[model samples]
Target: MFRSIRHRLALFTYSWHAIGPASMLRNSVRWSADAEARAVDSGFDARYGTDTNADLTPGEADILIDRHHAATMYLPTMDQDLAAMLAALPWPESLRRDATFIDLGSGKARVVLLAAMQRFRQIVGVELSPRLHLAAVRNVERVRDAGALVSPVRLVHGDATAFDAPPGPLVTYLYHPFREPIAALVMDRLVASLEASPRPAAILYCHPALQPGFHPSVFGQRDVFQLAVEGGRQTRGFLLGWSVWTNDAWLDRTTIPVPLVSGAGEA
Candidate 1:
């Protein structure tokens, strides 16, 4: 509950701006979220004119989460219904294998943390906020101390604009958390990374800004899912994207989702 009139007044004074290069409308809203006094209080979701607070380091996971959550004003990440849908989707590879998953712009490591518990062999969370990254690390230490899954989950404080995608088969997760300019830049680096190792890759995008038809032509085909949030009634939705580069149409003259003949299963 907003104890003071000053905070309550924000609802009327809310403002949102669409700042984009193309990936998603990141850096749009400025909401002061307080997670105090409640077991699970989803923070504020307001856009007060132009949020000018810039990015500040609060601590490892705490700071990274702030940066991640701050970049875009989405709430609680994706809803449960949508998350379940993603969990059910057929990944490029089988879940039985220790899939290499990387959460780009992994604010506070929530998604990545959950994945680590789900039995991924290794999970990496990349965040631009150093403070937030540390907070996430603390959370990890806490969970690990409590006997969570034994997967190797790591968090790095780095900018997504120019970070290198790990050289191997990996799942790049996106939350429609950043603007398109950054998104394209990150993708460009990812493409460059693939050019060297040329391993199979998949992208899981949720609450993504990229439209349904927003397919990366460089890849042969992309799998997408849309889960509408009827409670909100806006275009608010959950979308997941997975693109495999080596499987492109021009590559070996094939345009399909089937595993390759030679480097098929885990290329």
Candidate 2:
């Protein structure tokens, strides 16, 4: 617990240095209100709070940090921003009905619940932290009991890098889940899956890392994935960037809409 407090303090210090005090204050006020409203509307605890890794046991922390090179903290993606990102995708309704939606590093399964409300064939959330996974399970149960889920939902308590995607059309979502090494491995796994199955696949990356970048370029082979949409939303003046990449064989580039950089909430 002491270590977690220190880590959070260090993160706050860095954010204070990077964005200054006024912007930090504005974001905190606005985001807290938004989280409250979302929680009330959704009937679940999907608020922005705590780094999930902070709750990890010492042995778990050591193994994750030392062996995986994955240490990105958990922050729920904004409901509005995720909706805009999905709206930007030019997929046909028929395709959406056939494709499975998967949220990688799905903390508390907020994204999974949102996707469940969509027309996807199924919804899956892969989370590494046991603490977050249990919370997600509870939330899923609540959604299920309330009959709010349009599609079936599954929560997997496991590492994102090793999760094998089901074969067929897929829509994978990520919210800057991890560092470059693990991100690269996840991309490799996706590429291999596409190669073996040769199906339509799209990747939705929200709040992409800017430093030591983890973008579509991480896919390595430029011929496989193409950047279909690149945009973001501003939450009380703080920019949240997102991008969509489609497999080369899947999308009809001519049919895709121009990048959404305004109104929908791009800064």
Candidate 3:
């Protein structure tokens, strides 16, 4: 058949052009080493995979609002990507010690574990999928028993749109976990919460390749950065973007101007 020949030709072209035998051997070794290092560094099972088997029944259709609005696919955050994001943020020890960090669509709760390890005042992970939520609970226990988690943490098994924001300044994180409709709803809720409480808040969004125009309207101007990570044969770069928005009241209360000394060095 023509399709069969085309598939064979495509495979042959890919093997010769993209991943040859030599490159495959080298990449395998590199990938193995990277995986081992990551497993040791991250106390949870943070392997990257998808939840393609997610099932939504007719009864649950009301919650999901049709299949298209259902749960987003599951993928664990890479440890290096998390590091890169934290590096870009204005994360002082005082903030980490006092802020409540929440992760929307917290699959496997890897970021929650990271927050716990960082000694955040409070750590919360909201996940809609029952499967991933259970996995997150187990991972939480594992990390706590290992003494990697130093702060109090909780895992909420529910829709992110319905979750309530905690009191205090927040560090909200999103990993491109859902469609725009759901994300928009959740973000609007968060902004409303901030407006009500008037606190400083920041949102860390990773893999924001979808809906480039959505963030500005929600989070205002976000600082964008690139993270270079190795895929198979070569290194690939991804966008790690975040924005900090403070309530007017919170800013007025907390924003203090730095005192400028004139001719102090002349003395």
Candidate 4:
């Protein structure tokens, strides 16, 4: 509750940058974030080995925060449980062997790295922020140096709207990177790409806050469920959704809800 209050205060203070008092508050918040990031040394954060969630000021990331109507202020590492849930998707073995995985708005390349570990045929990450992109590149190098990645992976520093999907079957992942307008643009581009190639495609969307912006008829059936693991330690359950479409015209019109994981499903 306190953290939420602080985050709201930070955002409010950020909005009033022109004013003297509010500017001071924003600066203090920025300083605190930087200090937190500085405290993390080499391999500090186990997930990405970098302090991704800290150090970024709203003013510095205006393009991501304002230009795209993105709600996330900084790049976030994909949770390990979510990665496991992705691995547990009911995809065909043959399709998994051949599919190219793409992570849109892949801030620090956590998903990209995880996909590589999953042995996807090809892995791609698209990020809009140059600062975050640079960090992702470095993280990629770190993993490569440690002999972690086996599959071909590359990071592209570009806007989501400018990305072109790879040919053949593909699995695209999104973690609520941006709001409706940007998400709509990306979905349109994906539809255009599919129209050109007409191959099997699946979109794995986590925390789909702006899912309604996507066209209803474009997808076949969608799988919606919350991920939960039983045993040793449980990672927090997160609601995830996936939609798969193929080249067939008639099959594209089918719309059904297939609940796969445990717990209640959300739209």
RMSD of each: 10.2, 11.1, 11.0, 11.9
The sequence of per-residue lDDT tens digits that candidate 3 reaches over residues 1-267 is 996676556434433433356754545555345445545544445432222122222122223435323344455666666766666566567865788889998877878877787767889999876767887788788777777778899899888999989988787888767655677788778877765666667677764232232444555422111122211111232233433333444456545677977886776
Clashes of each: 19, 0, 0, 0
Tell me, by lDDT, which candidate is best.
Answer: 2
What is candidate 1's lDDT per residue for 173-195, written digit by digit as tens? Answer: 77655655566667767766655
Q: Candidate 1 at 119: error in angstroms?
A: 2.4
TM-score of every candidate = 0.58, 0.73, 0.63, 0.63
lDDT, candidate 2, 1-267, per-residue tens: 997787667556544544467766756665455445445444334333222222232133333535333545566776677898899887888988999999998877878988898889899999887778887888788777778889999899888899999977899998877776788888889888877767788888886222234745685453677888889754443456788887755435423567956685655
TM-score of 3: 0.63
After superposition, candidate 3 runs with Cα above 4 Å error? 1-70, 208-213, 221-234, 237-250, 253-267
lDDT of 4 at 154: 82
lDDT of 1 at 39: 15
What order do candidates take by TM-score, descending? 2, 4, 3, 1
The lDDT values for all models are 0.49, 0.71, 0.61, 0.60
Clashing pairs in 2: none
